[model samples]
Target: MMVTNLCTSPSSTITLRADEWVNITTIPNKPGTKYWVSAYVNVTGGTISLSMYGDISASQHVSYQITAVNAGAMSMTYSVVSGSPTVTVTSMLICTFAEYQANKTLLDSIEYFDGDTMPRA
Candidate 1:
């Protein structure tokens, strides 16, 4: 497994206005693998506008969301969060998974590097 740094906002900072949706960045989705998205938001629990396309968004706010696409890219957006009208994201992670059984010896290194988290996308 490997965790990859896909994209970040300019200077790793973004401030979203009330009810505003800002395009954070885009990520590529390779075939035959899953992506684990971890976003570091200023607020603990707030509505982070994350979805594939537009129809897949959830009703409530969530800090993280997973995307499973065949072969293409996804546009990420940040909208609103709870309690506060503005939200700032310091960083984000887009990790891809690689089977460890293929190489038993390398498992140790992967474990040390990511601790169960996938490495670079």
Candidate 2:
């Protein structure tokens, strides 16, 4: 089994202002490929806006992106963390299209069953 490491920044912190989009980090991306990103940002307050592109409003935050369509940038942003202006990005993970598909295939092979009936021990 291939192991994927979680990207963590235990001691790192970033501040975001209310109603303003702030660039957080950028992930390496490949053109013509898709990516699955999971960002774990600790926040407490009014709201938090996150996106992969700049100029995104709070209502425009997105979790998935196609690299080619967005000019191959995997940047991240946070519009606000309100009551608490600072936040810690506990962990994050970015999975490429190929890696996602490979994992999907592996999982299916190991856990999927065709019949409706339960398999006997």
Q: For this target, which candidate reaches the highest lDDT against the unseen true structure?
A: 1
lDDT of each: 0.43, 0.42
Models 1 onward score TM values of 0.44, 0.46
Best by TM-score: 2
> What digit string (tens of lDDT, one per residue) describes model 2 on residues 1-121?
3424212331234455455534333433456766654444555544555545333322221235335454433444466534444444423344565554666665335342211131111
- The collision pairs in model 2 are none
Candidate 2 lDDT (Cα, whole model)? 0.42
User: Residue 58 of model 1: what lDDT?
Assistant: 31
The 10-residue segment with the lowest total lDDT in model 1: 53-62
